[model samples]
Target chain A: MDLSDVRRHHLSVVLEHLVCSGPRSRAAIAQETGLTKATVSTLITDLLDRGLVQELDTPTAGRVGRPATDVGAAGHSVGALGLEIDVDEVAACVVDLTGTVRTVHRHTAGNRDVTARTVIHRLRDATQRAMADAAHMGIDCIGATLALPGLVDPNEPTLFVAPNLHWFDADLRSLATQLRLPEHFPITMDNEANLGALAELRHGAGQQFDSFVFVSAAGGLGAGIVLDGRLLRGAHGFAGELGHVVVDPSGKPCACGARGCLETLLHSDVNPDELARHLADALRTVVHLIDPEAVVLGGSLAAFGDEFALAVADHLHADTLGARWHPCAVRRSTLGADAALVGAATAALDRIISDPTIVPTRALAH
Target chain B: MDLSDVRRHHLSVVLEHLVCSGPRSRAAIAQETGLTKATVSTLITDLLDRGLVQELDTPTAGRVGRPATDVGAAGHSVGALGLEIDVDEVAACVVDLTGTVRTVHRHTAGNRDVTARTVIHRLRDATQRAMADAAHMGIDCIGATLALPGLVDPNEPTLFVAPNLHWFDADLRSLATQLRLPEHFPITMDNEANLGALAELRHGAGQQFDSFVFVSAAGGLGAGIVLDGRLLRGAHGFAGELGHVVVDPSGKPCACGARGCLETLLHSDVNPDELARHLADALRTVVHLIDPEAVVLGGSLAAFGDEFALAVADHLHADTLGARWHPCAVRRSTLGADAALVGAATAALDRIISDPTIVPTRALAH
Candidate 1:
């Protein structure tokens, strides 16, 4: 739907929420949203007319006299494309509103110029393949969203910095245009950590949390901070640059030229697999600063599993803060490689239903 | 107005915004808030009926058709009270909605027990005097809010820890009750730094920026963080304890029993006036980590003026981040000792105007 079709988009959002959260009566939806019951009933009726929602016969107890019908989103009204851009590989998937992956595609990075043009070319081919696979399964794809590891400007379709990809100043908007996608089809992009956090917030460990920081540890360390039920993109869209924050002054010199950045010490290259003991010792200082609910360890390194996460958590516990032993649980990302892709799909769905204007059509050309 | 009177509160809020922002046409308010023009018109009419807002008679050109009526809040409806509790003193003030302080009261402290009880006693006496003065000037007092330098449970009316006061687990709600406050009146308490940041967000340097950290340096250090237009209270209301975050592993011992906490290193005792040069060197590390919009210097130390703040800022600039130098501006708090007090008053006023249920009445006193 386009920006002009806000009413339809609003209905789609209610339908999507109902689908994600299971069936609920119009009264329940109105209660949760503070929307008028009449307005909700009208919206649900519109959704039913569009074949986006189905009313079930079941009635919830608590209503005195009248039986309320529960309505849920249709599972196959539309589909979303999720793209994940890594340093050496790209992964794409088609996911339904309920977060079920319908199709998947993976590609490797060649010795291409890691510029906007080159990445867009790879994305276009991958998207085509995924769409074809989905089509074979009778699934209709709607739009796409890309998730990458680096700084991203939400206002502009572009990468601020993707150090591992050796890309900088890449215009994602123009790249998507070159791919020749549908005119009004929307595309969205955000940092991998942010996407990971979004995924967790919607479908995993962070779902119940109002504030938490998701740390992605791979080629570089990045954080996705969710505060008060919203992602915190700082004043300059650089809020979650937790990796660049100085952790130790006398330690290793980072590429960012700062001494002992969280990434410089925590990354696999700096500590190595054999130096896990030393890594635990180094991490003690960081945990004391930001006392997050849970320090979620994601990315390729998290594949090592619970042992590594526990060792780091153990060392952090030994460090005393004001005679009170400060402890934060450390856990690995469950989605692993697909986390960012899932996050991207969620972002795309959110855009389609909440703010159609946010997604740049040019970014989805491929 | 009670919580049941939501429409009245909402209209009052619009009128309050108009009053704070000066005269604005209904069309302008509707555009600024994304509220429907019809809704704005209806609300404006209701506000005019209540005598909370008045329509301007002067007509201005520039509109396509008929000029809209300008509306603004009646400036003399209510006054707010702010109370600040420090280690050695208790300060109180009565301020108008426009942030004009009509009167202030200051009291000294001798010991923890005596101080806590005496502060509340003095606060009520001072508030009564201030109300008398306002009554003579024809302004009505609404409610009071207290700002304390410690961990506070907003859900519970108590001070968790007032280190300088040497009070722990003090029942502040009981004190408020003993003072015999008006029924259903709002009396709120919050962390000093959070309120300081709130004050800045609503009326100071932070108004233009959505996210930044406000560090209050006094006998100890505390931070007020604003992220995405909301305060980040963390999972537990103790999010902005930047002072207690361990910075040095083997540095001088802090009162909190940690070595080299930001507070221990930056506080007045650790950095005596004679050792300003040495303290400036230690302060550089903090400035690098959180490259905020501006490092606001508040508390008693701010009275020393630009020289002290500049010395700390000078050291921060010397420490480069990569090839780029950190350039967060340093400014002293304009509110002085009254900052936390003003912040508390604002918080109280916010609670009174938003949710009457949250405001503990003597009837519901523990």
Candidate 2:
């Protein structure tokens, strides 16, 4: 690549850093990014001209040097849309460059009609409303991300299988195409747990740790894992299926036709009210094995409050080897129902900045 | 950074490509590395003068230009040693830049006290013998890697636990210090399962896939997972504790004081013959969950033969979501007892090349 290409990419990178790592001075950015002061200055100038970044009035003073002007992402300059399709509901949200969800919408779907076309229609209507609201707010929607609960074949956009939704061999891309989205816009999709993990990594409790696991206890239990600072998507994009892992050989029968899966014991179907008790019993078995830094609880079950997180933590502490003094902290989701939406927005924003050619699009009307 | 620093690092990258991805002519290397032909030629000449690479006699004909000679790593220039300490045995091997194991030594420890000091002493003696034998056959060892079963804190050289061998918090670097090893020689220590996964990634069934899980079903059950082309060492280096994942809520009690871990189901406690059936049953559960690209049967359980693998495969097929089709392939480990040892060698080789300042130490004296 030419020097100009490198410089342009660096500019985008600086913008991303500003958005992800919060505000910082030019010198601080240079130290964090390992880019020279001259290069950062040049990139910062370019970003400022584009209205992507702005200098704050507050100056940062340190022991060794003069006060430096702090800079941060210009939240209004760029926006993204996040769409989440659960078994019973569809959620949409518009997020700004700094991962702030500015608007949210939720629509309950009819029971048991989760076919590919039905989901496509629901998504189309939801996106249209979300985009309209975003426009009303005077913000441009730059990209959209879709999150689903199932295995997504990364190589093939259309191939997905969500057991709870009874969706199999569905062509998501074809459905999106049928919606007639905007020409320049692109729709990105990923597994819900993966996106949840990404959200935690970028914006939640997982930010401090290089590796962590995020468990979503909803209709079914799933885990999003981060290792070496990256999402651990397996060979077929089927990793983090912690629910399917057998916690009992002859326990309850799971929807996946397996007996004694972790999901069978911890899923909402077992007993929504008693989920904390069930999760505590189940987690007592896993804590000693991995000894993770922390285990985060999200999804609808996390809404049960600190009681659920505490119950699991207590059991883990009691069951771990040597009564390991350090119990993996269990925290509830901070974003509530809007987490997946926020994650989807983050994913969309990441996709756009990583590859500027990607354009934002709206699902086509039937 | 200066332009020359970037250029030099870029050249080193080209040299690494030539070493790892086999040989290429100067012109081809230039195109692939995006460096100019003159730059490539100069680097290749410097490398050749240092005996790091050799030019092939055969010239290849191309449609667009004259034939050119291919240059490749000088296999005999540098070598690495890998040592694996198991509960019942110890294995050592020497490997070249091309990942070819040239010499191997296996010794029966027969349930001896395997403290860090004792293990280091044994390794030093074995290394001496192996080096002498290799000298007679014409081979050299430039670096060493040690693979041990435990929760290895990467930031520290002590092991948290090696349940099978009954070692806890064993100081590895102290043992190295006591041994008085050679200066400027690299030595590395890592978890056995992680090393086994690394070995498979570089030289075994996983070479073709970017992500896969290597389950070590031996005296204990553990896993080494690779995601997005990197090993998944969780926060605090305890990521792949697959054996500890609860597989049974009310089942047998695990040695880790947990109830029904995969290790409890899979490992052979007293005699291999006594636990053969249990091993097969546990392997079935493992195959049903992750559905990895390939299930490699290694450790002591692999010695049981294809019947064990086929039996597990049959159970997996019968219990999987879609019993109509097999989800993943099953295979026996080709490296057998030496898998972890070879992996250690690979890790040592990587460390030596990445940081030339590493010093190799002699084995600890009893």
Candidate 3:
């Protein structure tokens, strides 16, 4: 690699260490990253100049030599904007670089049976309101990510299809153009299920489990799978699609045009016992194929509480092949229904942390 | 990284390039790896001395400068031993470093309901005969991998359970001790389905597809999933347990203690049409979850031919959610029944390719 590329890489490595591992001394960063103390100090200085990191007042107390200064991700100076378009709502959230949510603007609108242009306008308004709130709180929006409830085109900002929203091949470029988002703003799109899984990985069950599936059952049945700490998007960015898995071949037709999908079997009319059974059948497919460490019930599913979680766990325990040995835990999502929004925000912040060079060198205006 | 670690890493990189990408001149290797020509030459010289790579007589002809000599993986100088223990047979195969099978010994025995010790004894005899054949062919075994029809403890040479073989927690370390395998011979254990998938990835349908599932239906139903060229082993080694996925949650009890499993529904008594539907249910689960490029059906199931494959594909097309946009192909296995054996041997060969330093420096005996 060239000198500039190498410098950018080192800068990202140092910044990521502080973001992921929390506050630590330069000596510890050098020891962990295997870079020389001089290189780390230089990178930290660059990050500080960019207002991405700040040195803390607390110093090493038990050191034999000079006490090293602890550095951490700067709060409120830099932030990310997360936008979401679900079947029944359009929401926006702004989170600081430290992953603290500063503002959330959720508008409960019947987004279904509507055109993509209408939904995008509503989302744009919500985003503007959320950005205003973030600016009021001293947070600077650096990048943005939009999470939609459907198959998202991984290469571009396009929502290929959302059965629940009755939206197909929606052109999301207008959202960026209408908002006048910067040319290099790092605006991206992702499936809400994938974003939810990412949020769980970053701030919830992911802290304890490296591999798990986050099932979102808000207005639709979907799943976000994490394997070894990475989201599994599959060959066509359509993975973790639990809603489409066929539960019965001769059963009812699904919204995706498939017959007898797991989504078809799951309905509000079904009693708790039957609901747990249907969920177990879908979770059974995940447990069989991925054998993840746990399955986090997120979105509206967590609202069912412990009784429902235990019922689903019982079914999983009884049906899974290696339940006698490797038991897949069924847990409730700590982030509840906001996982996808949080995940979207986290993904946006990751852009800056991944390449701190994007952040201009400037001090925080006091 | 330390100096030794860096050197070892570069050596492995050069060797892996030759093994995976075929023979290339020193200049090409240097250009591809971004290492200096001098460093590539130095690493190549070490590899040549170790008999892991051989210098080819054909040189680069169209280059502007001097014609650089081509280097390739050695053919018979080093080899690996692959052993397998199934419910009905014990087999062993030997393959040279270039992934060429040199010898194979198969013994058909009803290993079901038999003790793990008895099966291990038979496997040992088959391995010894194969090793003798390999020795006759001027191949020296550097490592070995044993593939079992059960869950393998990823951290050790232990078979946690093989329901078909009725073996639970079988101690495979004893087999290594009985063979008097070297302390660092790199002996390991893996699930046969996983081995089959790896083999397919290296030599079969994996050539055309980056992500696919290898379904093994010889005596029991199992699946080996490859996503983006990497095997998905889940949180535990028990991933790809497709047989136990409940098809009829209350249908019939399976050997795995799960009622209404897909395996329970799949029997000789079931007709081809019914069989295709059952198979499609499982494949649908896979496609919905992974959305792979294709699904390669292997083991005894491949014997059913194109008619069965087409029927299964029909069901998948009718049942899959996004079949129009992202259609998943259904294909028969090209390697047939030998995929697991080849995968086992290839994995053993991977040990040397992954760390060329493991092969001691020595010229070819000839």
**Per-residue CA lDDT of candidate 3, range A163-247, in tens?**
8888888877757776656566668888899999988887887768989999988777889989987889888888888987766
Model with the higher TM-score, candidate 2 or 3: 3
- Candidate 2 lDDT (Cα, 0 to 1): 0.68
Clash numbers, per candidate: 0, 9, 0
lDDT of 3 by residue, B1-366 (tens): 445766887888898788767889898999998988888899998999998889889844785867877888898689999888888898999988676788889999999998877777788788889888888888889888888888886667778888888888777776776766655667887888898998888778776788999999867788999988778877778899888776665578887766778888776478878888888877888888888999998997888999999999998888576677878998888888888988899888888878888878876566
- Cα deviation of B127 in candidate 3 (Å)? 1.8
What is candidate 3's fraction of native contacts?
Answer: 0.71
- lDDT of model 1 at residue A99? 70
How far does residue A196 in candidate 2 sit from its true spot (Å)? 1.9
For every candidate, give the share of true A-B contacts it also has.
Answer: 0.16, 0.42, 0.71
Q: Write the per-residue lDDT of candidate 1 for residues A188-229, one digit (tens) a residue.
A: 788888888888777766766655667676556677766655
Query: Candidate 2 lDDT, tens digit per residue, B1-366?
Result: 545545456545765677566887888898987878887887777666545567888655655767788988666656678877887777778787678788888877753454567766676776766666656655556667778877776666667777788887676775444445566555667889888888887778667666666777656677776665567665656656767766556768877776766677664353544354344334444443333566676776578788766765665555555333326666677666667888898887775445322323223344
Error of model 2, residue A17, in angstroms: 2.7
TM-score for the first chain in candidate 3 comes to 0.91
Q: Compared with the true structure, what per-residue lDDT tens digits does model 2 show for residues A25-73?
A: 9999999988998889977776766556678986445556688888997
Specify the highest-lDDT model's number. 3
**CA deviation > 4 Å runs, candidate 1:** A1-13, A24-41, A54-70, A110-113, A136-140, A268-292, A307-329, A355-366, B1-13, B25-31, B34-41, B54-70, B111-115, B268-295, B300-330, B352-366
TM-score of every candidate relative to the true structure = 0.82, 0.87, 0.92
